[model samples]
Each structure stands twice: as structure tokens, then as C-alpha cells.
Target: MKDKFEFAHGEASVIQLKDISASGRARLLDMAFARLRFSLFVMPVVSVVFVWYYGKINEDYRVLIWSALYCCAALVTFLILRLYREDQKKQSSEWLLITWLPRIQLVAAFHGLGLMVLLPMVSHTATIEFKYLFTLTLAAIVAGNATHQAPMLSVFNCFLIFSWHCTVLLMPWSFSSHWQFIMPLSVLYGIGMFKHALTSHRFFVRMIWLEEEGSRLAENFKLAKNAAETALSDKNQFLTTASHDLRQPMQAMGFLIESIIRRNIDAGLKRSLDDLKQSVRLATQMFNSLLDLSRIEAGAVDIKLRPVNLNSLIDDIALIFREEAVNRNLDLRTWNRKEKVFVIADETLLRQSITNLMHNALRYTKKGKILIATRVRGSCWEVGVWDTGMGVAIDDKEHIYSPFFRNEHAWRIDSAGHGLGLAVVARSAKFMNATYGFTSSEGRGSHFWLRLPAANSIDFSPQGLAVNNLFEEIKDFSRLTGSCLIIDDDPHVCVAWESLLWSWGVRTKCAPSGALALAVIQAGFQPQVIFCDQRLRSGESGFDVLRSLLHLYPEAHGAMISGEFNSRELEHAESEGYLVLHKPLEPDQLYAILSRWLQLKQN
Candidate 1:
């Protein structure tokens, strides 16, 4: 057996594998195996039927011929099955194809030849029936097996020519003169079949190539997508880490400067200190703006939607810019309808977006009035800011909302602008599902607007009155007194908070970790306010520390402070009902919170 297999491999390599490449040989093998398997299964039953029918007409030698044909078919089936099994072992794909494909084709050729040989043996009395059966069987082979054998077109052509010649030879030429015409037509049909098989072979090869290419492209696309996602994740992490590390010293500097400004000094020296403070504030604002843009691009901004009073929201935004506009001697006017207008939106984001538009308006318009107004348009409300400044050119309008893209006109107007405000506005508006655009003509002015879906009217009068009276109930910070506890891993942050708190006439204690804060509380230092950093040096979160201390000191007003702004952390802190302060806390903001806590304690 081993010797026979070795001989077969040698013959296959010389005859077929030498003529065709490895892939072509493999494909031919696949096609041959499929056709052979189908023939092996169906041909025996067909042979039995043919024998029984012919035996009724010629019983003498019909059994002998059928037995011979059956035994030949059985041998071929056994040989083909064994080859197929050997192929399945995958010893060597190239060797298997070369060895087995010829065997499969040889078996198919014999099966066709055997059927052709049987046609002439049928009795002449049943010539019509014999003709019908022969033609039907030939047609079946041409239609079904021809296409599957296309990968080896030579085998298909050989089968077609053999079947056609056999049919022509068995024709009853003496009985009918027209039978002479059948030979020529049979030749034409065989030619057509061979042509079709060639076409099918080309098409099959093309399809295989296309399928392989598509699979390769899909795999490449998946790898590229994974790499891009990993890069984006790394960028977000770096920004988060950098923001936290950079803000610690900035926070300390802000508090120290505030303490100095509060002391008695000459007017000129006070002006110098105030100028230094303004510079610090400007730096902080630019840093925060860049951070905001990064967060928005990283998909870290969360939108919280509720029914918002558009009129009041606009009023609040206008108030924030009114002082800045006044300092520049520009009129900041807000015009809204007498009736309340409401829209469903994230109030904080909506406010920020509109504030960005107002800031741009105030920055560009040196002397012209800035008008912020609301108007109804169809089913939407348009909150627009119009500034009589140098309008945008035609080409600049398209790229105006891109990050860090400043127009020539804008550059001349304010070198301090980082060109991120409008980018943030565009991103935030999209997040809230609001549409924003502008109408401008150069040398006239630009009107930037945001359109929001209008909601059904409801009474916001009570809420408006409560908001109006919030600042009226302020407590003087000097009268407020409370001891505060600070938990932060950064020594600079701890020192900054403690100094700022003590300067406000409040007693303060500091701990570097949650365990140490617990120790301080155990030592009987009761704090009215507890401020914790969100991230610590010991790989523990400030939230965990706050939770632990709150359990021990439930009466303490707890707040989480950090330099970095993350949506997940913000949501977590809010859900836990803890006040969150961003890093580089302003002195007035700290005093306000402490005074509120102190007032609550007194009550």
C-alpha cells in the first residue's frame, strides 16, 4: 500500500502539479471530489433501473452485462472513497491535490464512458425508449456535473466529446435519413457545453479572488479601528493625569495671592496685586477651556435634560457678560417676549454654550452694542446673539467652529482668544440635540443663533423668584466660624486649603489619607466642613475617604474637590449628594460655601 501511494504521488506531481500551481490544483481537486461523491451515491441506483428495464427486452445477456457494470462501479466507488479519506488527513495540501484530483477525474470519465457504452446494448425494438433515456441521462450530466467540473475544463470537455460521439454512433441512421443530421448538431452542442464550462471556470476563479480580498480588507479594518480606539483612550488618560498634576501648584498660588490681596497695603501696590490676580485668572480660564474641549472630544460630557426656562437662562447668561461688556463701554442688551419660553435641555451646557457666544460677541465688538434675544421660529425657539463687529468673511464661515481655528480678523481683534469657545459651543449644542448656525455678511455684523425645540408653556414664576432672591440671603464670612477637615494626598493642596480656610477665620485640620482623617476624628477634632480630593497619592479615591468620614461624622458638610473634570466622577459625586469644587478654588467661592455651612450649623 505504501509503495502504491508513493508511485501515485510521483505520477501526480509530474502530470498535474507541474502544469498547474498549488492553489489551482487544490481548487480542481475540490471540484472533482464534489462531482465524484454525487455520482458514487446516485449511479448505482440508476444502473439497477436500467438493467431491469433492459432485461424485460433482452433477458439473456442483460444480467451478465449489469453485473459487470455494477462491479466496475463498485471498484471505482471504493477507490474514490479511499482517495477522499486520504485527502481529509491533509498530509500535504499540494501533494494531496496532485495525487487525488487525477483519480477523481478518471473515475468521472469512466462513469460517463460506461453510460455511453450501455446505450448501444439496448434492444432495437425499444429504440424510441432507449433514445429518450440516453438523451435524458446525457442532458443531466451536461447540466449538473459540467458546472462542478469547470475548475478542470479539460475533464469536462473530454466527457462532453465522449458522450456526443457515443450518441451519434448509436443513432438509428438506417431507419431515418434525418438521423444523419443529428451527428452535426451533437457536435455543436458539445462545443457549446465546452465553451460554457470555460466561462464558468474563469468566473469561479474571479469570485474566489474577490472573496479572499474582502476577508483581508475586513481584518485590516478591524485592526485599524482597535488601534485608533487605543490611541484615543491613551490621550484621555494623559489629559486627566496632566490636569490633576498641574492644578495642585496653581491652586496653591491662587490661595496665596488671595491672602496677600486681603491684607492692608498702598493703593498702587493693591493695583499691582489685582493685576497679578487677573493674569492668574486668565491663565486658569485658558487652561480650563482647553480641558473642556478635550473632554468634549473624548465623549466625556454627559447631558442632563430638563424643562428649562429659555428667558431666565438667557437672562442669566446676559448678566454674566453684562459687566465685561460695560467695562469695554459696549451696550449688552437682552430682549425677550413677556411670556415665558421653555425648552427641554441640559441647563448647564445650554448656559455654557450661550455664554461662549456672548463672550465672542463682547470680545470682537469694541464699541457696538451686543444684543442677546429670543424669538419663535416655527416650532423652534431661536436664541441669538448679534454683534455689530467686523463680520466673518465668506471662506472663514465654514471652518469657524473647528477647534483652534482663528480667522485673520479674530486674530487681530483678540490675541488672547484661544479659538476654542465656538468649538466648545458647537460640540455642546450637538450633545444637547440643539441646532446652531449663523447669518453674517462681511463689514456689517454676524448673528450667531441656537435653535431648540419649544416645549409646552408652564409657570416658572416661583422658580424664577427663588433664583432672584438667592444672592439676597448671603451671610458675612467674618461672622461665620467653623473648624474644617481636609483630606488630600498632595501636600501642596493640603497646605493651600488649610491656609485659605484659616485666613477666613475658620479653624482647619489636615490629613493625607482616609485612615489618618479617621484617626483625627477619633482624637476628638470635630470638623463642620470636610473637603476631600478626588484622587490621592496612595492609590485610594477621595470618594472612599469621604464615605468613611461621613459614616463617622454624619453632621459634617462634605465636598469633593479635584482639578480634573470627568463625567463619570461628576455623576458619581452628584448621585451621592456631595458638593464638587473644581481645583484652584476661588477665595470668594470657598467663603460662600463655608459661610453657608456655618450658617446651617448655627441654625
Candidate 2:
């Protein structure tokens, strides 16, 4: 009842009105009664005008009597609305029957009485008056009973009776002389009523069918939701296992790279070594992307709101995709607002959204252009990215924001994407309370736009410093000496982890399940650090093995790893005295954590 009903559906409106706020419903009822009363009061005045005009023409008294009777019926209708309004307040069925039912019966009796009395005066034939008045009596029965019970049926019958009267009136000699046309017209009216009755029956059937369809749709939605939840859970488990296993090889790779740099080697060999190191860096970037995507989808990423420079964000995105654009022979262009504009948003998420857009643009546009632009529109700042390439179809626009929903067109070009780019962008925009939408025409191009509230608190003056300089103070620790224990269920994960770590010259021991890891640990072997996956095969868990290690070696430092971005389990692990690591762990992140741990030990 609190929700407005101005543009609501008919059935929704009826239900809403049926249970409206008492004061509002009373006011509405009073209004309806007032209109009915006014109509009844004006009837005599209108009838006098008509009577005066016809007084010189027919000199008949039937019109006056009929007009008076109609006025009386209108007064009864007004009283009925008033009584019904009062009936709404009374909960006792006995009170409603004692007061309201009698009033309705009296109204119906009056209508039947008037029709019987007036029709005989108009036409002196008992048969004609009897037939017409009987029809009116049937109509009155429908009206008085229909309003309170079986209302749709009552209303339908009312329309049928009125239609029959109008059709009889239209016959050539119906009012004056010949009763011949009455027989055929009566037959036609009966046929029409039969057809209407059949239609009413069909309406009920359709209503039942629609209800069944709605229930089926609701059931399907629940199943789909559960399936999506299960898939996400499995993905997170894999990521956790992979991250723990990967740390071993990444640590070894860093150790090897650092050791090689200190060796007595020529410049050419060192340069080749640097290339290998860069390849590791690339792998680390990919690993970070996977983790970031997982965390964003799992809603584990906490967004912090701060004043962000719109122009700077767009420029950074354009720069990131510049090489890709150039390689594809696409022009990468950017335009900024004349004045510096700031918006309150999460800068990291904003950057990620823009980056996704730029990546998508560059990926699709082979020989055209990718443009990033920003402008002030009324109260909002609109940031847009456009790509001139094979555009999206009209039907694909509605589904583009769904997770893992790649358009057929995008799949044709490159099917490598997991279809999460736009989904991330949409989620980020919603979290920031920003507006996001895209426009695409067939065979032309696509343009995506995000509008955010312009913020007044941020400093937008250019710093004239590149983002690369932001990390200049960060030192590299390529030559780290350590041994690690990696536990995971997946063999491919173990292979990748070991290779990455061996490249860094760190010794490693890997076990596919926690039971096997426990067996190895019991034989008197322990690494400097231990990394265990949360989910292991054979119903054995990393937490179980880690607990066993802690009991055996009380001073051992351990980290629990998961591929999933869901941090609830990780948080629980951290609370239980374990360092928690997210899956798809980057080489840099692994190095950073190990470097800090080693430094603490050395100190």
C-alpha cells in the first residue's frame, strides 16, 4: 500500500487498492459517493429540459416517470458506496449482513420495480413489458450480488444486459409497432451472450496457464542460482590450491635469478638472464589478473572511496593499451575535459574498469581506432571509450553485462576471454553509485560510457610524474636463498609451481595431498617455510596438515593458500594463526612475503 500505483498493472492495482491505507481508502470511497450523489441530484434538472422540449411533441408522461426512477436508482448507488465504505471498517460478518446486504437488496428491488412499472406505461402490451422488465431484473440481480462476490462475472453480465437493450433499441420497429424483428434480434442477442460466456471461460483458463508458467520460471531461477554458486565455490578451491603450489617455484626462480646475477658471467649471458627474468615478470602479471578477476567476482575485493582524477585514469588506460593498439594498426586517441574534474570513487576499481574497456577496444579493433574521452554533462562526469570495429548485435546488448556471456561476434574474433570484462565494469560502476551503459549499432562500432558524481574535494592539478616512478623506491630481491614445502592436489599446478620456483634456485618438496605431506613431515624433514592448499584430494585438507606441523614444530611459520577470492575462509585461517594467501599468487607477491619473513628471521 505504501508503494504508488499510478503506472501499475491492473491486477496489481486492484490488490493494492483492496488493502490500501484506511485514511486513503476512506477518502477515495467518499469521492466516489460524492460523484454518484451529484449525478443523482442533477438528473431531474437535465430531465426537465428534455421534457420541456418534448412536451410540445409527444405529451407523454412515461419519460418523466422513467427519469424519476433513474434518479432514484442513482441515489441508491450513492448510498451503496457509502454503506460499503462503512462495511470496510466492521469486521463482524453479522453487522455487514444486517446493514449492507439489505441496502443492496433494496437497491436491486427498486431497479426491478422501476423497469416493470415504466415499461408497461410506455407500451400497453403485457408481453413486451414482461420480457424487457424480466431482462432488467436479471441484470439487477447481477449488479447487486456481483459487486461483493464474483465481481468479474457480475460485471460481465451487466455488460451483456445493457448490450441486449441497446441492440433491441436499434431495431427498426422495436419501440413503436412491429414485434416481428424482436424474435430474430432475440436469437442474435442469445448467440452473442453465448459467445461472451465462452470468452469468459477462456480467460480463466489463460489465467491458470499464466500462473503455472510463472511458477516454473521461478523454480528454474532457483536452480540456476544454485548451480552458479557451486561453480564459483569449485573455482575458488582450485585457485587456493594453485596459489600455494605456485609459491614454491616462484621463490626458487627468484633465488636462481639473483644467484646468476652475482655469478662471474659475461654481459651477453646476463642480458639473456634478464630476458628470462622478464618472462617470469609477465607470468606474474597474468597470475595477478586471474586473482584480481576472481576476487572481484567473489565480492571479496573491498573498495575504498577517494576523490579520483578522471582525466588521469583515462590517460593511464590509454597508455596501457597503446602498444596493443599500435600492433593491431589501430589509432589510440584520448580527449579530456577542458578543466580538471574530480569524482568520489574507488580509484583502483575505476582504473580496472577503464583498463577492461581499453583492452576490449584494442582486442576488437584491428584497423580502425580506439578512443578514450571524458566530459562534464550536467551534474555528472561521463567517461567513455569507443572502438570502431565489428559492432555488437541489437539482441546482445541486454546480455552483455551478464558474467561469462561473450557475444557471438567477440567469440568469432578471439574466444580466449572468459567473458568477465564487462561484468566487472558493471559491478564496479554499481558499487561506486555510478551510471554505466553502452551503445552499439550493427556494423559500425560500440561506445561504452560511465557517469559518476563529480566530487569537489580532490586535488586535480597535474603531478607531471609517470606511474612507473611511483614504484621506483621499491627494491628488487631476486637473489633469495630458501627452501619451501608446497602442497596441492592438482599435478599440473605442482609442475608449474616447481618450475617457477626452481628458476629462482630455491629447493622445494611438493605433495599432492595432505596425507602424503604429513607422511613426509613425520620422517624428520622441514622447510624454512610451509605453504599448504586449503582443499586437497582424498578428503584431506591443508589445514589438517598445517595443524600437524604446528604441533610437531611449534616455531614453524606457515601460510594457507586458496585459488578462490572468497576471504571468509582465509580470514578464519588467519584468525587461527596462519598467513592466508589468495590463489594465482604472483611471483612478486610471493617474493615480497618471503623477503619480509626472511628479513624478520635475520633480524
Question: Candidate 1: where are CA atoms >4 Å away?
Answer: 1-32, 36-75, 78-99, 112-144, 152-192, 229-243, 246-382, 385-485, 494-529, 538-558, 563-578, 584-588, 598-603
> How high is each candidate's TM-score?
0.56, 0.45
- Off by more than 4 A, model 2: 1-324, 332-352, 359-426, 429-478, 482-527, 533-557, 564-569, 597-603
Provide the clash count, candidate 1: 0
Cα error of candidate 2 at position 381, Å: 16
Q: What lDDT would each prediction earn against the true structure?
A: 0.71, 0.60
Candidate 2 clash figure, as a count: 19
Model 2 scores a TM of: 0.45
- Choose the strongest candidate by lDDT: 1
Each candidate: how many clashes?
A: 0, 19
| Candidate 2, 123-210: lDDT as tens digits | 4433444445444444443333233221123223333444344435443343455546564656565555545544443343334334
